[model samples]
Target chain A: MSLLEFLDYSGVAVFAATGALAASRKELDLIGFLFLAAVTGIGGGTLRDLILGQAPVFWVMRPTYVVVCVAMGVLVFFTAHLFESRYRLLVWLDAIGLSAYCVMGAAKGLAATASPTVAIVTGTMTAAFGGILRDILANEPSVLLRPEIYVTAALSGAALFTLSSEMGAPLWLASLAGAILAFGVRGGALAFGWTFPPYKARPGRHPDDVM
Target chain B: MSLLEFLDYSGVAVFAATGALAASRKELDLIGFLFLAAVTGIGGGTLRDLILGQAPVFWVMRPTYVVVCVAMGVLVFFTAHLFESRYRLLVWLDAIGLSAYCVMGAAKGLAATASPTVAIVTGTMTAAFGGILRDILANEPSVLLRPEIYVTAALSGAALFTLSSEMGAPLWLASLAGAILAFGVRGGALAFGWTFPPYKARPGRHPDDVM
Candidate 1:
């Protein structure tokens, strides 16, 4: 398989594992694990394809991706308890998936739209939206609302990839650099609890008064 | 406009109003209200189109649907506080949208897929998924998890429409009957607190043991 294809499959598997772990925490049944895993594995790409007008979507074109997700869900279901810190493992696995998806999504976006701004936005959405769906379905607090820098890493990675490609970098080099930068930023957040400042509402500003 | 077309637009507007009210409850800014309104208005149709392989999606093709949603957001932003019970209004508006979407979604699905089962599923999703997305984005407990018969109402409406059409009923008659059934079921739930029995897990059945 090509490097990009390999990354795509691995990213789907890793994200599915994280989803299964989430299901385990919720004490859901096997069906729940499979459902969550499948959704988290492919939700981002599905949304991206819909927005970009890619008919049949990625998984509908290649059902192997769903098989891979189901396999990860089954694997995680039996073995989740063996891990001492499943949450930590889920976070790290998600980081890996995020990095890969950002570059791949950006590459696909650039190819389809030929617009760097759209590519960056699609890339970020591809990386982060699956996790958002996972959290929402599992009734967990959204990763988007967390203090740590999650989406920022995906956005930056996508931006970097778009910039590098625009600057005439080789495809492989751009992909590698983008993935590494994303993983590094997310790693820093996990290791050091790095975060952006939370938004503080102005006390006197009312909703009705704003518009 | 045709009756179906009119219902579709009304559904979008009503759904958007509910979404704007959700944003109001969260005390979000104008942008947040618009974003939530747009998403809640079109999310279900977007998903249905993607699954049915309809390229460009409904809103992208019309664009007027999005304009309707934005108008609702702006109107609700300024006028939301005037309602004595915003939640009750939101629920009633949502019920109206749900009933319309179920029939519309079923019709579209049957036209696209030529399968009654697919039509029913798509109809239910079109009716309910937008509200699910709204609640998730607004951090409200999902209507799906509520004891009330929400999805069941959508599902029955879709099924009824598909069945009536298959039985040689006129399009308008089938549509009206299906919509009224959905609304009646939902209204019964709201007025009488009707609910399906909750799922009960069997004791000693473990996830690992299931498969």
Candidate 2:
């Protein structure tokens, strides 16, 4: 397989594992694990394809993606007891997936001749949307609501990739730069528990009181 | 406009209103109301179009849907306090939207020459996905997990529509039957608090304890 394709599959596998871990945490049934993993692995790509009007969403075109998710879910279900720190494992795996998926999404957008802004947005969405769906399915507040610098990292990677490609960088060079930048930011956050400032509450202020 | 076109627009308006109400309950700002409303209004149709490989998503192709959502958001933001029971309003509006969207989705699927089963599934998705998404964004537990017999109502309507179409029923007649069936079931659930049996607990039996 080409390097990009390899990276894509790796990202899918890691994301699926994280989703399965979430299902285990929720004490959901086996079907829940498989469903969550499958959606978490491909939800972002599916949304991006739909927005770009790409027919036959990527997973539908290649059922191997679903197979991978199912395998990951079953594997995680059996081996979860072996992992001492499931939360940490989920976070690290998510970081890896985020970086790779951002690059892939940007590449796909560029391949489709999307504008730079649209391409970057596509990349960010591809990286973050699966996790969002996973959290929703599990009835947890999404990481997006945690004041984390998560989507920002995906945005940076996507923007870098789109900009590099626009400036005539080779595909491999551009992807490498994007993935490294994304991983660096995400990995730093995971290592340091970094987060952005939460929204300040205005005491006794109603949202509609002013308007 | 045709009756179907009218019903589609009405459904969009009601769904958007319901979303806005949810934002109001969450005490979100104006932008939040608009965003949630737009998503709830188009989420179902977008999913249906994507799965069916219909390009440009319905709302993207016709900006009027978005305009309607925005208007509904602003209106609700201003008038939400006037409603004494916002939750009731949301449920009633959702039921109305569900019935209309199901018939519309089934028609769209049949127009695409999809199999009867696929058409029925599409219809159910189109009727239910928006509410699922809205609940997620609002951080409310989805009604789908409430054992409310919600999806079953949507499925019955879609199945009825597709079957009638296959039996040479006219468009208007088939759609009417489908809409009435969906609305009747959903409305009855609302009026009588009907629900399905929740999964019984298997005491002390772990999901992962087995193979």
Candidate 3:
């Protein structure tokens, strides 16, 4: 398989494992594990495809994605207890997946002739939306609501990838640069508990007045 | 515009209003209200188009849908406090929109030559997924978890629409029957607090063992 294709599938598998781990935390059944895994594996790509007007979503075109996700789900279900800290693994794997997906999504957006801004948006969405859906489905507070700079990391990577693509960099080279930036930022955050400045409440601002 | 077009736009407007109402409850700013409104107005149709491999989602092609949603958002922002019980209006408007969306989605599915079961599923998704997205984004307890039989109502309407279409019923006739069924069921639930039987939790079923 090509590098892009391999990275895409690895991302799917890793995300599926994270989803299964989440299901285990919720004490959900096997069906819940499979459902969450499939949704987490494919949700971002599905949304990106729809927004880009790309017909027959990636997984629908290649059934192997579904098979890989299901396999990951089953594996996680059987071996979740083996890991001493599943949450840590989930975070690290998710960071890797996010980095890879950002580059891939930006590549697809560029190929689709989307404008630079839209391409970056697509990449960010592709990288982060699956996790958003996973959190929502598992009834956890979405990471979006947290102070963590998660979406910002995805956005930066996407912007870098789009810029590199526009500068005529080779696909692999551009993707590599973007992925490194994303992973580095996310990895740093994981290690150091990095976060954005919290939004301070405006004492006199009425909720309706802000509009 | 044709009758279907009219109902579709009406559904979008109503859904957008409901989303704005939700945003008001969250004490979000103006942008949040508009964002939620747009998401609720188009989320279901976007999902349906993606699944059906329909390129360039319905709103992207028409543009009017977004305009309508924004307008509704602005209107709701100004008039949110005029109504003493916004929740009641939200539910009734949501029911109306759900019924209209079901018939419209089913018609599109059948026109795309989807199987009856697929058409029904598409209809149900189109009717309910927008509200699901809205609730998730607003961090509300989703209607899906409520005692009111919302999804079941959508599914029943979609099934009836698909069945009637397969039987060579005219579009108007089939749509009317489907819409009536959906609204009736939803309206009854609203009036009488109807609900499906809760699933009984089985003891001794390990979360991982079911796989």
Candidate 4:
């Protein structure tokens, strides 16, 4: 529980930073920057809770997550230049955030008394959804249908986490292993240009063929 | 059933047109335009279906909706100028579309095994979510959470439709009444500056206020 809490706060801080970085590119106001940060920081968990039919949502219930985001927002508002150089650092931090949230989401699902498969899928969704939403809000493409291996890495980590838990592993070990695996897979994908292939269908009279 | 089909198709076309207007403003490519149109036309339905746990979603089950979005995309591609003035036209067309879809969604929910309350909420949600998605995609503020009475109008229409149906009213009469009610309410709000008051929570200090 201690580790989970630490990771949740840390993940939120990193996501908030990246979100601030992303928003800076849009040249929006301070409110927009903070809104982006808040959305990216807790967006995944909120979506997961909503889909699970949970009430109040995590951020709404605890409300600390919003504070964390706002704090980061204030920091970014003043120190935005700290993030201007070397976008590579942002990517690594994002991967770490994703890994943390992946394990957290799985743990949340398990706590919710869902089945293993449901837990695994839910965890992956929790990890991936924040970035997807961030991309959408940033006016970039939604990452859901993108070719990237983002979802796959989260899925891999979540599967391993669920499997370990089913095999009687300790909760702490399960979470640690899942986070490491997710971080590694996403890191590898970033380094190696790994991606899912394009979706295919019958290639006939559709005008969409020209695209 | 025929009325349902008509409203459903009309909603698709009008929403697609609205999406095209958004995309044209951004000078999006064909892919982006088509994607935006699809999201605008079917986004509300997709959200409603997912929340209701409806499987295989309407577009996934029937490719025709995708085709319709693509076809509209092509039309917009060739004649973007014809829609140069569409935003003005769309204000009313969208109100009509909202009216049509609220009743459609309510009817679908009422027919399904869901509770009446859920049905009522789902119907309003179904009518409102498309524009919500469109604004999100267009990187504009969400109309749903705005001071505008967008969601309230949809709720009124949905209630009217559901109640009329339960009273054994004919489908046309119920749909017409619901449509007019929704349209009028939304129109009135637009004309008269109606708005939802902000949440009543006391204002807070900066950074601390977010929580």
Question: By DockQ, who's the top model here?
Answer: 2
What residue runs in model 1 are displaced by over 4 Å at the alpha carbon? Answer: A1-45, A55-131, A134-140, A143-211, B196-211
Decide which is better by lDDT, 3 or 4: 3
The alpha-carbon lDDT assigned to residue A192 of candidate 3 equals 88
RMSD of 2: 7.3
**Candidate 3 chain B: 10-residue stretch with minimal lDDT:** B26-35
Per-residue CA lDDT of candidate 3, range A1-211, in tens? 7778877887788888889988988988888899899999888888788777876788999999999889988888889989999888888888988988888888787777556755775687688888888888888877654445576678779889899889998888888899889988888878887775432223443333321
Candidate 1, CAPRI quality class derived from DockQ: incorrect
- Scored against the native two-chain complex, candidate 3 gets a DockQ of 0.12
Query: Candidate 2, residues B14-120: lDDT per residue as tens digits?
Result: 99999999999999999999999999998998888877788678888999999999999999999999988999999989998999999989888778745675577
Candidate 1 chain A minimal-lDDT segment of 10 residues: A202-211
Instruction: Find the candidate with the highest TM-score and give its number.
Output: 3
Q: Positional deviation of A85 in candidate 4, in angstroms?
A: 4.1
TM-score of chain B of 1: 0.94
Candidate 4 chain A weakest ten by summed lDDT: A202-211
Ranked candidates (lDDT, high to low): 1, 2, 3, 4
- lDDT, residue A10, model 3: 76
TM-score per model over all chains: 0.60, 0.60, 0.61, 0.57
Q: Which stretches of candidate 3 lie over 4 Å from their true place?
A: A1-10, A13-17, A20-43, A46-89, A110-124, A136-140, A144-211, B1-3, B9-39, B50-93, B114-121, B136-140, B144-211
DockQ of each: 0.11, 0.13, 0.12, 0.05
Give the higher-TM-score candidate: 2 or 3: 3
* B1-211 per-residue lDDT for model 3 (tens digits): 7767877898899999989888776655565566568779878888888778786667655666877987998888878776656677788889988998888888888888668877898999889998988888878778898877899889888888889888998877888898899999999999898888977557876545554
